[model samples]
Target: MMSDCGLDYIELLQQEVDRTSAKLLYLRNEEEPEEAPPPRHTPHTCSAPRRLAISPGLGGKPLTPPFTENLRRLLFGRTVRVFNFDWRKSFFHFREPNSELSYALQVDQGGARAVQMVIQARIIKHLLFSQQGGSEGRSLLSLTELGPPEQQGALAAALSDSLWLAGQEESATVTMVTEDDSPKPPSEYRLDLLTEKMHTFVFNRKEELSSFLLDHIHCFQEEGGHGVVLFLYSLVCSRTIDRIREDLDSSTAHLLQRRLGNFVCSQALLNLLLTGRATPHVCNGTQAPGGGAAPLDPPLQGVLSRGDIGYLHWSREQMDRDRLLQVGSMLKTPRFPVWLCCINSTYSVLFSLTRSLLSDWRTEHQFQLFYYNGQNSQNSTARLTIDTHSHHWEAPSVDPGVDLEKRFPSLEMTIRTKWEGASINWGGIPPFY
Candidate 1:
């Protein structure tokens, strides 16, 4: 027994050494390169390309996003107990084997959900865009497809890329917040760039905040750096509140709202993360009133153009009681076959391997769709078989007592937003919300 215990201890020590060595090497090799040329597709590597690169080493020292206690209270509702988050203890931390799967983000928390949501978005981008062939590149990967470390690296790349993009948004200066002369409660604190006491980091035209972001990818990725909050600050600083207000009129588009002692992102805020603009509605371009003597209720701001990622929203409660707002084609059919979904007010993701699932109707007949809810509770990626042509329930004569709206699952409703009359099959697995 003593000899066996000794052997096990030695093996464990060796494993630890190997893991540490591998991590150190990965960190050094993946440092962001300057004006990186388009990366060569190596399924083995996760290097950032030119658009995604954040050049390091040129700057005097590594930059961490200057988040302070007061600022954390103001934005995130509370500060993390540690100055830097411990990856081992938190659900937010990415680990081996589990990292490659559809990892869950503790969404019902403070603004931190933004980090998880954005990470998921980036992973989706990496998986969809990273496929090999001309025809095959249009495909998407399932939860278990990529290796653990590669997916983790992809998360690093994606988080950095999002921060860089947020910085690149057209704003006059990058806004940084500090305590005002007259202190206020955390609940009352807000981001107001025009206020006299605010501190602004001036990154004038052409120069972007991403220059700082590229170097500090780990700050957001590994250290629990409140990346999404930091990027939100960068974006708001760039666009300014005045411009954001105009994007959705002065009245609507509230970026954050109070929820269960913490705050969560509003629709406009979610759109801003997905796209650069904080338009409230999910439609194509700005929808204005028809040329008639109608009251000027302000034009609706929406997705100005197609983005690399897309969005979808549906609520059983919203559909049953409130005004039924339909999702437009712009978000319903994106340039890619992936979407960040809000179903019954909970966030989940739905994607397809086939790119032509939208543009060409013929491809929709019987294609597979996979769903990821970011919960460890999910037994498997919900593989849904959509039969657009074979669905017989489209006719009104089917049954009035069936409560048509409740009869269809929310996921099916979400898919029907893109594929209008399609029927969904859960493949013998009982349908879940």
Candidate 2:
């Protein structure tokens, strides 16, 4: 009954609605798949960003300029392998590009002194002087063979100290080996005279010690020599001072006492022991060939005015170049008993490790002193470690001597074959265990 146009319009509208519904269903089907899984938390199984670091690599910040420059000079162009000690983990971590050239040098935080001294003195000396006189100079020179006996003696002393610091005491040996293939002359290094007990005088009270030395002041003087300095060194090493008194004779001691000066080597040595720095200069009644004492604004005490201390292994230019070394603090006094003593940077001396210098007087009474004769002589190779707490030379039951081979054979061989005069090892392979 409806009109033809009206009925057709209604039908068209219905068709359009049906078509639109079909197109929407097709589009929905194309957009999403039925097999897709739902999203989940699962935080434990997933990876997250790492904590940001202050430095580029896992290793912490870079070494300071002074340390870097030192490494650079010591290793030259060699690749530097860094070994960081993680106190937290109680282990060492190493880093490098290639395992082969990565670590040619090893530097620890606390033990840099040993490496530093060796590089500055031994390696540097060989590099600069080994080629002299057109003969390939031996890298290792005995104390006896070197000239300027005083200078050689000092260097030998430093080497000996380094050995002890490395804990190579009993492992080290003195042999008849020479730089050249020449006949092994009588072994300069001897160990027979060593005794178990060191004749050391321990004074808990400084004033008492001062009084005693002052009373026997004449026993320290020498003709044209710094006998007081030597005496103090001997005392620190726990050498038999009574024997020295005997050797000098009573008449000489009396004459020396009468001729003693207000400022003597003893005072300088005492200052070194007390303050860890020698203030007075030792005067031998002789003027320098060229000039007077270096004009220090603050002024220093003692006899010799010029800087009497010089490292034969270190040139003035080299010393000035290294800023960290320029300051005398590097050689500052360590805690008591553990002394980093130097004889004008010419010789090295060390006190006992068995007792700390700061130990309570009530608990422990003595310490040990170690002395290495680095002079270029048959006896230059000998090392004397004395138990300073005991005043007696011969303790009947005590074992005074420590056999390096028996105690630390591996360490001794390593030192002899590897580290004796070799350059610093960056690989951290030098048995610091």
Candidate 3:
């Protein structure tokens, strides 16, 4: 037994050493490859030949950054402990309520604003769960739940009143009242009674509650941006549901229902903002152009005005072409268009997503109001053709004799990258419920 244990320990140590060595090599730039020039191809008269050069260094390579180290540190570092709650349930529960809030905001806004409007709503509620140490199965703890549509008219009234009262001292008062109102407070309010109860529960400890709430609020604000706030809320709710089930054997179907509701509400709000109508509130709302309300949403309408719908339309086209190319590449078939389209779409999507997410209000206004309508006098076009005559290649037989484990070693690598990116993106946002 002793010898076996010793062997296991040695193996573990060796593994750690290998991992560290690999990471150090990467950090020191020893694992990166040099760049190469593009292959010669038939070029269109209006465009330069497309280059197929590899990037020069580690950072130059797209989607190949060293994320493991960052992830490891984030996971192991000291983290703020927010109470685990079922996300899906919270989402579904809040969906209708938030949708109502959105409807109210629209009615209150009254279709007169020159600029786009945004209304943020938050609510808190109590939750109950099992506590193994205190009871046979569980117990109840007073916690806070943040969501929208605390009541029917409260959110809309607050948002509308705030908008109308902007640029005045009353705006701050309105904001505070909206943020601090107890959505479902008990009928009776006795400050002295609550104070005495709080004193009695001193032994239970409560300092962490304030800190956790602060942390959550800070994280939420920091993650605020176009679509980020909604996305973060969704992520938190999903993760909470997952954590609860895995850790507590809790049934999360109810939670999932709630999460769906929240998602619907968010979608409805987004739709309302985009389109000038409340069609998104309908259960069978149409999303396609011309089928639903004219012009769809504001952002999309803005895109159309600029004639840059080509950006997104081109992206979708490229994605389809890339999918076909990947299959062709695997089958060793002719894949010139597929490969080119895949690379081009990948670059374009990267640029567009980044720009859309990071561009500020000023930049967006400038683009939409001025540059979008202007004509590009110096229009240019380019094309390229792959010359595979000199390249020797043979298609492998369709027999299932290939060693997939060795041939597709990078499959796991690709999956890990995608998962890591998603996690990082979601991590910055606030929890839904």
Candidate 4:
């Protein structure tokens, strides 16, 4: 009986394995073959050979010294600002190579203010080989496609390597303002220290640091205060992910995802600065987003809806501010509250100003606002109060009458004539007295 029972158990185990294998085979057969990717199109076919030469304005005379120094600093510097530009139609147009390229670099030399440097260069080599891809051509080096982990790793490796290279470059006799009293560390040491601090900062405070960095990014731009505000506004003005997802359109969702991903990555870089390991600086060529390269997924693809996006923005803003306050309070620094309040006031003023401008535009165009309580006759008697004061006035016909001021008004004229035809059932309502 014991031998028979053991044999039966072995048989059952064999049967289960066979069943699973058959199911796996059936699923594999049912799967459709992946379609072959379309052939990659070459945008520019011109094979003209261009000499390797730095632009005149990149650094006054002798391209070798300043060019190498600045490039090294950009790649390995402790505090670096990651810029994202639209580059729709400018000399630095990523789509097409022009005669010249222009960019502005700013470095905070451990002083009260930042040092501004402008560099205009010509593109000599559009492509380079990377360890991951042999002879693979790329328009720009993008951290977004790399994903967060790989991007951070690559940046760390690059900074380490660049610092070593910077040390090898011949030193110049020309002297500028040296802020550090101690002899400047070899380029490699400085780079290592900067990168180490950044890693520490990012590891500690992920999202909060990113948001704070984005808020103060304007101070790093070369276009000065005027363009910085506009630039930042454009960066944050894209439609939310939820709205894009609700549309159920693949292309649009991809576009939004790409943009959102880029914004998130840019913010992540800013978060790296709060570690106080190094002062922040900006690099010229690295200024543009997607910098002539197409996103693997466009901004609109796989994006969240408008409501969700708004919530995310609000949540991030609140959390970041709260974290800053907590950290500042712990440090017992008086400057923290003042700085936080100032930034809050600036954002509030900007939002109000923009809203007013948009409202004026809507008024000129005869646009209107429509509201609804989303209640039926069964719930009509329920006391409801709508706040119109917070909303912008668009259509003159829709007025907030004195009756609405009462605690329990007989009628609430919240819906406009436009919405009445679509969202409301006017036939059921009593005729106006």
Candidate 5:
């Protein structure tokens, strides 16, 4: 009953995994972890090519693109298309707000892991930039030094504080799988970690958590440690399990749902990543389902508080059927100008350097907004000009009888979330979305 083509595909995929894995193993052994990175890094200058933003590895070196590319190629192989914006391609710095490489570190993919990675990026940003005199990049630059008791304590305290804030004032919960030995990740190259022993941890106080994490930092950062996932678990723990449960409604029982042999994030998980409340919907606040029937148990949760970054969602599938959820103002109007946009279920980031881009209406007439699709093809940042009050978006050239919502490019609709009735001029750069 088995077809030869299917068998060939499996065999080829397995060979790729093995080849990539071997290549990485060789690199890890032969290559001494790069010198402890400079404690302080200058902001990405337009002069140098910006590497994909990936977190440091077990070796304490900021992961480079080739290495992360190999990671995704090894783990997902050809099964899933790899993107530069995927968590695997980025690195984490202890504190570097003025860094360009940091921009690509967020997850632009579809799974629960993607959501957690996004939340993890926010947590790291809060730790590094939010606090004025917190741990410097030097503190995290060389994880090899975590063995030292002093450094271990310092790292722990810093992580604890960040996670505390990540909880949004509520306690957090950290859930992780326990591994006994070996540096390599589990079967299926860390993709099939279903049977690993899982553990949930709570630190009575933030300081008390310093030792365990410092001692086991390798378990989180090592080549096979599932470092990102471990980091997410720690953040969740700081928020506590109870809150995570409350963040979900009857429909979504967990943060991730498996599909097509891979895992993807739920809206609740994404809301948690954005606002920390894990509200499932995109609306401003909790709302009962339509039809005015008796409200369902555990009323639908929307974003309660705005997070550091905002989210914009536009689904053509949902819009075509007139099922688009009107994302509320709270999400549309965030505390910051950066937004993680979900266009047709794929994630992309749109941001402006001007902090007042959202609050100040005067600056909206003509401005530059940068976009990154996370695809490997992109070598430089794509810049787009948004011209509001320029063209008459109100009057379309198309027949009045046609459905307008389905006519416009999805990106225009997403941007309109903030500008209301602005026209988008691609500035001669063909709009991809």
Candidate 6:
């Protein structure tokens, strides 16, 4: 037994030496250029170096050196923590209390790549949220309008790229073509242009946007655009898309959503923002037969009590036609009342499941409301309970026991005023019930 133990200890020591040697060699390698680029189909390696090449300003202009330094200082200035949600997996949490935001970065393999992805995500969040007076006054409108037109485009592109990174999908920035397909230059899918079009479509002509979305829904399912689609979904939830009507045909919309829901689990991201947990749904990728694409394990499949806590655009007409898109009509009611609100289409806000907001009305009661300033300049909240409280909606009202108003004053007012005096109860009772 002693001899066996001795042999095991020696083996362990040798392994440690090997690990240290490999790390030192890696550090040395960074100083040298590779003689040849990696072959196509190499996954995480391609995006990292390419993404670093991105300019921090709009329209490919690099920000001043101090700009990034300021962002880093703002993002990581206060306390930060990281923890594992699931023991068996390699997901990590990147959080800062000062920002009140958490990000989920998934790692399927043990290496430096996972850490790189997390750091990438951190920079993206800083660029998106912290740049615009933190989460309270956070607005894509600000991102778009705060700087020069050129800078706006750059900022939008950064957001698009950041969302792609967080999704952990293949790198769109680094293109590698196989014989089966032709190369798609990264310029083809300019997120800044796409974002501009989305804004024009959703905010200008609502009907045209829906039709346009239906026609182009297939693009979202493709690997590279999935992140963009997710970004749009969150944008819509922000209530940026106005005049969502039921007469509009959304079969294509439903199909696209189903595919996206199955393809990626966004709850991990939603949770990180709402509750500061970095737990996202992940599954081992299993390549399909005949070398087809592999699918991500549906993260929300096993969990009960359904709630989505991101920006949601709950169109009454759309929901009336198709209940599948409706949160309240889901087959299973979450243990806590769902807190959903639209924060305009320009940005997204995080929500948590809380029952304290629910009030007694009937066994089952639900209603929704919408608000827009005839343009895209409005935010609204969707209460998912049957409470018939005759409370008038007003701005500057704080959520009881919550400092949401303080965190995001502009957002609170935007949502609060939209629901003013428009209470609807389903119990056939009067407003005074």
Using all chains and alpha carbons, the TM-scores for the candidates as numbered come to 0.65, 0.18, 0.17, 0.17, 0.60, 0.24
Among all windows of 10 consecutive residues in model 4, the one with the lowest summed lDDT is 113-122
Q: Estimate, for each residue in 74-178, the C-alpha lDDT of model 5 and write its tens digit.
A: 222321222211232222222222333333333334453354345333443443334455332322222222223333343444455446665665444444443
- lDDT digits (tens) for residues 1-433 of candidate 6: 5797898787556545534443443344333333433222211111111211222221222222232223222222211100111111121222222221222122222221222232233333444443444433333333222223323232333333333332322211211111121122132121111111111111233333333333433232222232333333333222211211111121111111112111222333332222222232211121122223245422222112232222233333332354312222221222233223333222222222223222333422334321111111212222222223453432345556543333333333333332323333223322110
Supply the global lDDT for candidate 3. 0.20
lDDT of 1 by residue, 250-299 (tens): 43535665554335666677776776667787767877744552686667
Question: Residue 427's C-alpha lDDT in candidate 5?
Answer: 70
The ten-residue window of minimal lDDT in model 5 covers 44-53
After superposition, candidate 1 runs with Cα above 4 Å error: 1-92, 95-111, 131-148, 167-215, 237-242, 288-294, 393-400
Q: Write the per-residue lDDT of candidate 2 for residues 136-157, one digit (tens) a residue.
A: 2221232123223223223333
Q: Score each candidate by Cα lDDT.
A: 0.53, 0.25, 0.20, 0.21, 0.52, 0.27
- lDDT winner: 1
Pick by TM-score: 1 or 6, better one: 1
Task: Give the root-mean-square deviation of each candidate in angstroms.
Answer: 13.2, 34.1, 28.7, 26.8, 14.9, 23.4
Model 3 lDDT per residue over 98-133, tens place: 231221112111111111122221111001111123
Candidate 4: Cα lDDT at 245 = 29
Best by TM-score: 1
Candidate 2 structure lDDT: 0.25
| Candidate closer to the true structure by TM-score (higher is better), 3 or 6 | 6
Predicted structure 4, TM vs. truth: 0.17
- Model 4's lDDT to the true fold? 0.21
TM-score of model number 5: 0.60
Model 3 spans > 4 angstroms off:
1-278, 281-433
Q: Residue 266 in candidate 2 has what lDDT? A: 31
